[model samples]
Target: MSTDTTLETPSETVSPILKSVNPATGEVIAEWPVHDADAVTAAVGRARVASAAWRELGFDGRKKALLRWVSYLVNHADELSELIRKENGKPLEDAYLELILAVEHTDWAAKHAKKHLSAKKVSPGMLLANFEAVIEERPVGVVGVIGPWNYPIYTPNGSIAYALAAGNAVVFKPSEFTTSIGNYYADAFAKANPELPSGIFSTVNGLGATGAALVASGVDKIAFTGSTATGKRIMAAAAERMTPLVLECGGKDAAIVADDADVNAAADGIAWSSFANSGQTCVGTERIYVVDELADQFVAAFKDKLKTVAPGSGDTATYGPMTMPSQVEVVRSHIADAIAKGGKAVVGGPESVRAPYIEPVVLIDVPEDSLAVTEETFGPTVTIKRVKNNDEAIALANASKYALASTVYSKSKGMEIARQLRVGMTSVNSVLGFAGVAALPFGGVGESGIGRIHGEQGLREFTRPHSIARQKFAIPGMELLSFSRKASTVKLIKQVIKLKHGRHT
Candidate 1:
């Protein structure tokens, strides 16, 4: 991790501030005090103190409190949706969808945590037939969450809800671009449960230094969502204290269209998956592989659908602008590189990339090794490649280092093709279907991320397993090894063991 002290120091005469800007309009929406390293450490200390009482509340108490918080969010959904739209530059409908998922996960975590984490008895082996064994899941003190701007509400709640359900206090550090939304989330929960400790759910707003400080503040666990490079730096910083962390990083997801696929349905699903939220989604499809026999048909259908899709901040727009201004250049560079290397732009090209708002670009005939195909182009752009068969499509999809999410469209072999893709979750004949199902675990393999954040696995991620064993009684005639035992007893025991095992040997 970079230990550069260029950020605001404690002794500075003036405190710094973080400015939240609207990406679509390039206007400053709000300014917040930037919490420095000391502030973050203090927040963690407070949370640690509050965690004791939180754990004492037990499963039922915690569940009631979390549901109250969920009610608050539901009652004020409209106001929260508008704020999300302003901060993220996503369509209003998309913002509402994000809020809905956040609420669902919160409810799921509260309702299921006890059933999954409570103590359960296990049968003892024959050698220990008189013993009883049980296992219990315990909370891991305090947790620090460093969230991303994209899907601001839904993504972070994956950790926050589960951690709180497991009885751990949390100190959240949302992305600088969406700090206000983070404050809103923490404040709403505080208002819903006035009797709860202040640090039970807290927010610290700032840039990179604040996040780095949270990692080293001795939090029991850290849940992070962001780029792979940033995840690496966080992992290195947390290594000093050996703090366990769950990382939900980037993904260059792919979709495969089999020869027998429903071309119209596949096209519609591909368009939405590739361009929704201006292609800012971590699981968005960056690459498409279509069987050779249906490649032309799929492309034609996809282009026709793209004609109706427009990028804007209005309610009618199918998608909106890129939330981060810096991401525009990265998208432009990838598209330019692909075009410069013999790729053809079937719909839009490098020239269509405008700051904040990038018109959807569909590229075809791109080489398999191009940056657009090989890297995570987090923009409203996708590359379509023709494959000789389903096997070839599967091979191309698995070539990337990322394995977060994938999509496959086929009339008969959807499941078979989906099983071959090396990704954490796959949607057959659909895009991003696994995310809507609360029971499914979400996360990835390889560079995509480490650990899970939804369903039963997600709830357990915030807890540690504890096992207990007790002896019921001593068996009679089990003292053959004592000095007083007769030689005849030892011989009988050996003969019994031999009769049971000698035939197999």
Candidate 2:
């Protein structure tokens, strides 16, 4: 949930209110009270105080509370989805799809928290055979989550639900553009479980200043989803306090079309992955590298598919306008740059970038150094290049600074191609399929950001392990820990070391 202006704190502090504007019509949808540093501090303090009680509830107790919140979300999904359509400017069907993914992920986190976060016993080493070793997974207290706007519900819920299920209180600062949606999400948890403390799930609403304050608010852990640049700033700010961070950032995800691929199916899946939500998806397919053998058929099929996709404010439209206002210029510039270079637009061109709604723009044979191929174009645009072979296609796909996600559309060699991609998650024979599995960890490497926020990894992200060892009995003359140990003890240790580890190569 980031933009060029995201997380920018003003030098002169003033009461800056967030005026949520509908991107489709430039209408003022609603105004929200800004939360300053002091307000953010208070929210974190409250969450810190509630963390104790929340952790004391144990796994089963916490699971029940989480499920209750999920039910509330499921029941009021329509209302929430409607608001998402209005504020976020996504189509109603897309909004509903987002809600479904969010609730399903929340439910998975609730049901699986105990299995992933419970205390467990471990084997004692030979030297400590008389002792029992146990490891306890303890909550890291309060976590501050800075969410994204492109995925207002699903993305934040990835961190929020997992953190809550792992027995940590959460202080969430949603993207300022979707303040109401963020508040409505946090409020649902309170309404579902009246017995929980006020700070178990809370929100701090405002612009970039509010988010920056959350990082400096002394939270035990920070989970953020946005652009790579913003993530880097937060990483630096979080370092001062040695706070743990989970950053799910930007992606210039690529798709590889091998000679043995299903041309039509590959085109359809890539088209959806490229243009869905106006191509604002962090894991969206922004680049395509097709083998020369299949390049002509693939490009033709992709063009046919793009003809069915259009961006508009109408309900029946395939997709909606760009949620972030500043991103429009970024899209326009990328198109202009690609054209200025020797790239040819086969389907849509510069005229496609109409404000708010950017019609699908597909470029062929664009220079690899062009902005559309190098930087993250969070709009309805994709650059397709024909490579000599799979090796060349793989090389070009892995050249980007972003290593977030990618897709491979090879029928016979899907897995082979997918394994060669330099990304956190890769969908074989499909596009963006990794996101549908709640059990799969989601995040990235390099500029894509740090850490992960799903599956067992997500449950552990908000926790720290505490190890305990108890002695069952002590040998009278073999007390290794005693100061009065005999010289024979040293001789025995030397003999054991020679008989054990010393034998290994």
Candidate 3:
């Protein structure tokens, strides 16, 4: 049974508190004061004040400060990993890996921001040949980030680090379940760079109301990560203020295996991708389509690999318990619906979804429209279906309304098959390879969410371009801007246009 405790309500306690509980043992790991709408507004105001000074630091200065903070994170990685383990119920190794990824992203953002965001010179059009045009990316002032709990450090840092590097101050509101980790990250950054203005990396802790308040707090822009339904609500709220937003919502990602693929490697990748981090990953494999000839072989290999997988808090455990207790019920409901609708459970079944932990569950021949297949299960559960050929597998993979991430395993035509899937990012022979390469943009199309959060595009997301056109020198015979110019100038312009472009048209 899950021992998770409900957060204290105003009527139940003298003061409202956001408690971070250990999902494995249901122990209260930490508590933070619940910030209300007014408090969130104040934090954004402070960030607005701090943004001026932060922007003044320029790219090099900000990069130095950010690198200092990264050094602190790397130095104290062990302590941070343990904290992640206790609060998120993920294994220590996975927690450490998350930290390493976060640090790498922070480093990348600091080093690459200047190159990507600096002003660039461009040629003026023929009609404005006397003018010099330049485009500069300017910070969007204060940015609000409402982050997710799963992979708390790595996921939120995707926004926080890039925003900071792009010269914007951030007001981050982590998921209610992972508030401590958020606060710790902010605190560490502040300690590493005491000279930075306060509120440059501020945080607001609370539940759903707090996030809504952040959306309504008049921040220059918002970056949110959560469910598609919640993302819609956020869009509605931000619409009132006409604020720009980047919504990184849920994903029903798929993996396609071709008949020509290496069966053993594909099976190993599928099993790991399906169950890693207890399958709570946004880009994790939830649905798989395998070509008919290799379906049985792949399934056998995947099941054989799953037999050694275990869920616990110990060192040797493959994965820990579910980070959110409520998620267990959702996983169970999806599996139950699939089975009731004639899906066959090849490995674990509905009985596997105990509180706190959901063991790996593999279902074969699941109905395409079933909840487990159609929706974001977000657990250690996956559905496998066999298709007639590669074309049918590609069609099935693109059938999801959400197209966040995908994987295609084929020796001869990996990239060819990957190009056919309509997803934001696809790994040819591996899972989530796009995320590790900081140069690639990461986000999705359709219901998966909007905007991106990595690479040059990610840095530019927190900024707006400011174009400047200066009249360097006036042309001797072309006074196009002045009505005082004679009709002869217009005739000459028409003749030049005819000579250059008329023939092509």
Candidate 4:
């Protein structure tokens, strides 16, 4: 939340330019234009007009363009990764992983859109027996996407790629912190398909106000990703126009380490889940439950591995500084609350000082009511609790307000435990596995927000279902609708209902 007045970028190259700052070293990387309300409105209007023709191009042509975009991303993998790393302060490796997910999504959506969205035959029912019925996906005009700063590429691409493949033009307003990366992706598409109008996929770089403009711009739909609080506001804005929206927001995901689990593997997984990208991920593990028997072993092993990662500048580093400084304060307060409530820091404490980066801290015996345990810490901190059995682990995990995603560590009981957890997606014996599998839907319920983002749900989120029913012939029982039914016809209807609906009596 710390805003540096140092101009984000030169105004000539791009108006309303954003300053790209490197969180790890407090250096301004670069700046690009900050688009205004009028510009964003124009972008959505352009998409609306462009979609009229784009939709007619049908599935095959759109798929070709998306596939070409994939090739563009793959050829410039290193370049894109660098752009992501510079704009958002994640490690280069993590940035590469994000790009990889984007590539996979592009290919998946292109290959599977027709299968998921194309017309499908359905039963016409007795009332309309003479008619045929089918369900098809229709492009919902213009789709406005407001992406988050974390995982800027993959998360936004989840909606963008799918919307494009479904034949809808997109107006993307990336988070102010990661506008440059968003611009880079949009510009690549413009280069790949010069015939596509400026609005087929446009990027407007600005703050919250610009996003609000898009929501108010009469776009057919809005796909947004960010904090749960902000998501509520977006939902309200979309409600103003009765616009349909898909919100993929925050989560307080948990991980369970059963007695049968491999302690080393669990420790390694927890380290990655909690500290990767400095714990900015929406599905990152915030709370961990271990069987009482293995509680001490996990704490010791986890601490040993965490000590190996030095948070600041180094060639051999596992994590970088937090992308946003305000998050550092939130992490600080959560740890303090845990300590005040009789929790012990097994590794580093608030006393441990570091500038932008915080030492990976592990809290033990934290009260379930404590903020660190109940809310999303979104930092390199995790609360470890001892559970008597798997049932207790499941209960504790489900007690949170957010039910986005979760992980399980066991050999035989992994799938069973995963099924018992109240989450949209679970990674059995791994962390964040469902997201890597493009076929599975990725989203949440309850406070974690509604709607799906990946897989078939992802493709359909941007499209409307268009059902077509054609009559083959008149029904033999036309008397039913004509009010001319006879006693024998009523008797026949009763007999058929009994035979079809009731058990053969």
Task: Give the Cα lDDT of each candidate.
Answer: 0.89, 0.89, 0.89, 0.83
Give the local distance difference test score of model 4. 0.83
Error of 3 at 406 (Å): 0.2
Models 1 onward score TM values of 0.94, 0.98, 0.97, 0.93
Best by TM-score: 2
Q: Write the per-residue lDDT of candidate 2 for residues 1-505, one digit (tens) a residue.
A: 2342556653337566788888888889888888888989999999999999998998899889988998998999899999999889999999999999988888899999999888899999999898999999988999999988898999999999999999999999888778889999999999999988899999998878888889999999999998888898889999999999999888999999988999999999999999999999999999999999999999999999987789898867999989988899999999999999999999889999888789999999799999999999999999999999999999999999999999998879989988888899999888888897999999898899888888999889889999999999998888898899999997998899889988777
Tell me how many clashing residue pairs each candidate has: 0, 2, 0, 4
Candidate 3 regions exceeding 4 Å error are 1-15
Candidate 1, superposed: residue stretches over 4 Å from native: 1-15, 476-505
* Model 3 worst lDDT run, 10 consecutive residues: 1-10
Q: Candidate 2, after superposition: displacement of residue 157 in Å?
A: 0.9
Off by over 4 Å in 4: 1-17, 475-495, 502-505
Which digits, one per residue and each the tens of the lDDT, describe model 3 over residues 1-505? Answer: 0111222221222247778899889899988998887788899999999999999999999999999999999999999999999998889999999999989999999999999999999999888988999999999999999888888898889999999999999999988888899899999999999978899999998887777778888999999888888887788888999999998887999999997999899999989899999999999999999999999999999999999997998999999998887888889999999999999999999889778888899999899999998889889999999999999999988998998999999999998998898989999888888888887888998999999998899999999999999999888878988878879999999999999899984
402: Cα error in model 4, Å: 0.7
User: Clashing residue pairs, candidate 2?
Assistant: 1-148, 1-149
Name the lDDT value of residue 429 in candidate 1.
93
Q: Order of candidates by TM-score, top first?
A: 2, 3, 1, 4
Ranking of all predicted structures according to lDDT, beginning with the best and ending with the worst: 2, 3, 1, 4
